[model samples]
Each structure stands twice: as C-alpha cells, then as structure tokens.
Target: MIDEKGILFVLSGPSGVGKGTVRKSLFDRATDLKYSISMTTRSIREGEKEGTDYFYKTKQEFEDLIKKNRLLEYAEYVGNYYGTPRDYVEETLDHGKDVFLEIEVQGALQVKENFPQGVFIFLFPPSLEELKNRIINRGTESEELVKNRLIAAKTEIEMMDAYDYVVVNDEIETAVQKIQSIVQSEHCKRERVAKQYKKALEADFS
Candidate 1:
C-alpha cells in the first residue's frame, strides 16, 4: 500500500468562537492529526510548557527568527510576538501526519498565501447572541474585554467567506463530526488519488 501525503489544516475564528474546544475534540478523535505549537514571546502561563504549549522565546530571539524567515506566519499582538515555526510543520507533513493549526484570522490568511494547497476552515458561532454568551460563560476575561471581543467577532465574521469551509459550532458533537467529514472528503480528492494511481502504474511498468 502507498503511504498517504499530509495536509496543512488551518483553523481560524474569533475569540470565544469555540475554535479551541472544537479543535480539542478533533485532536482527541483524530490520531493521525498533529497540532502545531506556536512560538511566542509572551511569558508562559502557570501550567504551560516551553516546547509543548509554545516555544517561549525572548523578544530578541523571536526577532532573529523573523529576520531569518524561519516563521510561517507571525504577528505582534498586544505587545508580544507570536508565530508558527516552519520547520516543525514541514517535518510533520513529510512524515504523512496532517498538521492542524489553530490560528487567528490573519495567520490563517498568511498560511493560505504561503501554502496555496492548505485547507482552511473558519468556525463561527450560530449567532452573535450565542457568541456573547459563550464569552461570558468562559469567565476568563473581564466584562470590558468580553465586550471588546464581541466587537471583534463581528468584524471577523465578515471574513468567513475567505475560508474554504465555514462550520457553525452550535453543537459540539455535530461540529466535530462535520469537521471530521470534511477531512475525510479532502483525502478523497481526485488530485491526490490520481497521484497515487500514477505512482502505482509507473512502479508496475518498471
């Protein structure tokens, strides 16, 4: 049997849009899928690790990587630089492991431009009201921050059409299933299957 090639899966959404939750579920259910850990200049949180959660780096170190063009997509957010490292993602794909990147809208767009074949999915809440409730329910941010996020969510929703697929995460299980189905469908694309068949035919002829 021929080995399968990996794909880059980009997942993007606004804060409190359940992107993290859905991504966790997809990771739990999909063993072959690998999550990309980003590199950030922000201080590590209480329980986060350096390499696992994020490659914690100083401002100078991150700037050096940027200068060397080592990052796939990077941005300075809230006084900290966060970015995805290119080597790890490319290595994972070379090993036939599908890499999933849970990134912001800007990063997702950058990835799409860098890797035209990448699959991009935008997860959205069922409605604005539900999004507000979800943000409040999380209880991690202050009321003012929640309000600001709501405004940002509205703006982000406008970019949904840029993604290849929009998944409304109204229900967790259903949303997870939909994402899984999308991945499965992508693996069946004619281009990928045709490449496999052509390789097999060449081997047989040889």
Candidate 2:
C-alpha cells in the first residue's frame, strides 16, 4: 500500500491444490500482473529454468538471506528450504506493477504480518477426497505422503477465515474470473485513489 505502488497479491494453500494453475491462468488473462519468483534450496528438476521456475540457492546462501532480513517469508518443506525474497516484490511494486506470490499457508501468514494490507486469496479444492486424488495423481509423492498432505489440508482449510477472499476451484475458469473481479474491486477503493484526489484538490486551490 505504499504510495503509487502496486498490490502484493498473495495466493496460498496446501499442496495438490490448483493454486499454481489458477495463478497462471490469471496472469495469462491479465498480462499486466507481475509474478514474484521464489528462492529455494531444493535441487532443480528437469525443464525448470533458474529465474522462471525458482531462484535455486544453497542452504547457506538461503540462511544468509534470512539473516539479512532480505526474505519476506521462508519455510522448509519436505527437507527443502523455500522462501520469497522481499526485494523483487518491493522493486516491482515500486515500479507500479502488481506482484503475485504463490506460497503455502505458513509462508502466507508471515507475509500477512509484514504486509498487512496485501491481498490474501485462499484457493480451495472441491473436496478433501478430490484433493487427495489430485495429489496422488501427480505421482510425485508416495501413499503415506499423500495421506499426510490430506490431513494437513483439513487443518489449513479451517483457517480460511484468516484470508481476505476464498475461491473454490471447482472450475479453473470460474475461479480465475472471480479473482480478476477482486483485483478490479481493490483498484476501486477510495483510499487507493486518495493521492489522485489530493492532487486534483491542490490544483483547484492553486
């Protein structure tokens, strides 16, 4: 909410949810939106680009960033460290471009503390059973890991009230449209336009 800066739109949810897919569709439709790339200590997988996919860093480097308060939020997941660097988001926002972040619930909460005015959107799966199926279908995790994620999803969903908005991902298109509308609405807030109003009034007085 800095003067003339852009909104820090945070998208967060448990694993296997379609947060990434929905985020992609949103930016595809709204090309003006900027994506915040995350930094990770995890090894790069096949077909993943350095900046586009993630800013892969060593554990020591990531820890140094944390020590310097350069990272907005960070957490270890499945033995890999991941975090959102504050500089990129702030720089893009200062340029008057909205930046989007896809993070987990834990990391999102941290952002909430640092950027209270940020737009927090929670993406929900159609159902827990379907969520489990989606994770299993990914074929990345074992049966036990899938079960653990499902258990965690339930707890995460219960905290949905903590977010500014929640969209049920029954259909990706519908979800994207709803989020798009939310952005449009946020841009219309009176406080967001106060600077323009003040400038106009000053000109009249002059």
Candidate 3:
C-alpha cells in the first residue's frame, strides 16, 4: 500500500455562521476524518467529558503550553483561554488520519500560517441579516456584544479570499453535503494524490 500523510482541514467563518453546527452534522455522517480536540481553560459543563468535549486545563497550565509553543493558535474569551494543541494535530496527521478543526476566523488564520498545505474552508451565512438574527436568537450575548459580533462578522467575511473553498450555510444538510463534496474533491486533487501514486508505481517496478 502507498503510504500517505493525512490532510489538515480547517473550517472557520464568522462567529454566528454555524461552523459548529455544520461540523457536528458532517461528523455525524462521515467517519474517516478525526476531529482535532482543542485545549481550554474553561470549566467543563455537566454534559461535557474530558478529552471528548475539550482538554480542560488550568490558566497557568495553558500559559505554560503557550510558552512552550505547544499550541497552534489560542485566544482569550469570557476570561477563559482556548487553543488548538499542536502535538495532537501533528501526531494525528502523521499517522495518516485526516484531522478536522472547526474554529473561529482568527484561529483558522493561524492554522493556515502553520500548515500552509491545510485545506482551509470558509463558511458563509446566506445573508448578513440572517447572521445577525442567529446571534441574537442565541440570547447568550449582550446587546452591545451582539453589535460587536456583527461588525466582526463583516470583517471576517472579507477574509474569504484566503480560503480554498466557500460554502454557504443556507440549509444545514445542504451545507454538510457541499463540505463533504469539497473534501472528496480535495482528496482527488492531483497534487495530493500524485505522491502516493508515484510511490505505488515505484514499488510495482521494484
């Protein structure tokens, strides 16, 4: 068999663009890709489990990891820290398993810088009005924070040029299907498959 390193797929977009929802739905049906678990200093909720929901850590521990350059990207939110662990992602990729990350725009950009070959996808809302409504409907954000989020969303949407694919989150099922199709197409890309094919040919000749 031809040995191949796995691909890193980063899915990110505006805050209220349904990145998490689409990701969860995609994983519900697809089994080949492994989810990249993030480390966080946030307290685990009742329904959450360690190593599954998030790799919980203390603030100092998280700071130590940051100092050691163990995280690909990190951010502070609501007085808690959250970040993607570099070691886990690298090990998973090296083992020939595709790794998926669903994150925010800033974190996604950091991953792109670290892994330039990663498949970066930008999720988009059908409209700014719809996005605003989604965030407001959550009822978790204060009115001021909601306004700030909309402003941030506009800026994030402008960064769509950086991504390899753009999928509109009009319908959950449709968005999931499009993302799956993108992954399939990426796998078939000549640049990704050629190396393995060449190795297979070399082995056959030998």
Candidate 2, 1-206: lDDT as tens digits = 32566889888887789898998888788367788999999999999999898999999999999999889898888998888888888888889888888878888989888778899999999888889889998888988898888989988888777799998888999999988888778887888998887887888899
Candidate 1 regions exceeding 4 Å error are 42-50, 77-79, 140-147
RMSD (CA, Å), candidate 1 to true, equals 2.5
Clashes in candidate 1: how many?
0
The candidate that wins on lDDT is: 3
lDDT of each: 0.87, 0.87, 0.91
Kindly report which residue stretches of model 3 are placed more than 4 angstroms away from their true locations once superposed.
43-49, 140-146
* Model 2 pairs whose backbones collide: none
Residues 84-123, candidate 3: write the lDDT tens digits: 9998999999998999999889999988887788999999
Q: What is the Cα-based TM-score of model 1?
A: 0.86
Mark the regions of model 2 whose C-alpha exceeds 4 Å error after superposition: 1-3, 41-53, 56-58, 77-80, 140-145
Local lDDT at 97 for model 2: 88
Best by TM-score: 3
